[model samples]
Target: MKIISAGLPRSGSTLVMQMLKILYSDFPLQKVHGYIEPKEGQIRICTYRHPFAAAVSNARIYNDLSDEHLKNSAIYIRKMAKAVDLYTEDGVTLMLRYEDFYLNRKLIVSSLVERYGTKFSDMLVEKALEYSSIERNLERQRVYSDFAHWDSETHIHGGHISEYKGDPTSWRNYVSSSQIQILVSILNPVRLRWGY
Candidate 1:
C-alpha cells in the first residue's frame, strides 16, 4: 500500500513517518510537509501539534522570531489546520497528535497498526519506538550538525531536535508575552480545534 505522511514542519511528522516506515517495511511512503489532496489508494497518516509550540520551533530553526516569522508560522499553521479538517472529515486518515506520540508512543503505534488493518508483535512496536526515540535522533543531530547534512533513512537533519523539553508549553520560554499574544490571537481557531 502507498502511504502519505502529512503534517506541519517540526511537528514530529518525521517521527511518525519513521515509525510507519519501520512498521510497514514494504509499503511505499512519502512525506508531505504541508497540506495535500489525498490520492486514490493512499493511506494518510497525519500528525499535528499545538500551533504555539510549532511556531516556536519554526522560529528557532530559522533563528528568527520577527513579526514576519510569526506571520509565516501562522500561515503554515492555518494550512495544516485545514489539512487536519480535510483528513478528519475523510474518516480514513490516521491523525496523530505530537503530544500523544511523545507521551504514549506504544498507544500511538498500536492505533496506527490497527487503523492500517495490520498486526505487529509487541517487539516490533518497541523497536519502532526505540528507533525513533529522541535520544537517538539527538545523536543524529549531533553527527549531522551541518545544515547540509540530512539523514536519508530518518529524514532528519542537523539541529532537528532542538531544545526539546518534551513539554508542549515550553514555547513560552522562547518568545515574549506580546509574541505569545500574537500567536494565540492568530491561531485561536487551531487551539480550539486541537485542544492545545
Candidate 2:
C-alpha cells in the first residue's frame, strides 16, 4: 500500500513524513502538502494544527502581518479544514494532531505501525524518533540556512521551527491581541470542530 503524508503548510506534516520515511523504510511514502485525491489501497496520514497557531506561524515565517496575509491565511486554513474533514469522514485515513506529534510521538508511531500492519524493531522505532526529533531538525535548519539549501530528502528548511517553545499556545507570544481576536473570529469554528 502507498502512504501519503498531507496537511497544511505549518502543520506537522513534514515531521510526520520524516518519521514515516524512517519507520516505513521498506515502503514508499510521499509528502504532499494539503489535499490530494487518494487512491485505493493508499494510506493517507493527514496532520492538522490549531488554526490560530498556524496563522501565527505563517505570519512569522513569511514576515507578513498585513490584512492581506490574514485573509490569505484564513483561505488556506479553510482549504485545509475541508481536506481534514474529508480525511476524517473517509474513516481510512489516519488523522493526527500536531500536539500529538510533539507530545506523544512514540504512540503516534505505534498507531501508524499498527494501522499499517507492519512490525518494526524497537531500535528502528527509536531511530525514527531520534532522526525526526525537533533538535535534529533545528540543527538541519542551521545548516541549510535558506530555501535553496534545504534538505530535500527530509524537507527540513531553514526557519522551519521559528520560535518553538515546546508550547502549542506559544503563538500568542508573537501575535498581538488584536491579531489574536481576528484569528479567533476567523477560525473559531474550525477550532471548535478540531477541539483546539
* TM-score of every model versus the real structure: 0.89, 0.90
Across 14-103, the per-residue lDDT of candidate 2 in tens digits comes to 888988898777768978765677688787898888888887777666667776687677667766687787777777888888877767
lDDT of 1 by residue, 34-76 (tens): 5567678787888888988888787776677797798788777
Off by over 4 Å in 1: 36-41, 146-148
- Report RMSD for candidate 1: 2.0
Which residue pairs of candidate 1 clash?
none
TM-score for candidate 2, residues paired by index? 0.90
Off by over 4 Å in 2: 146-149
| lDDT of predicted model 1 | 0.79
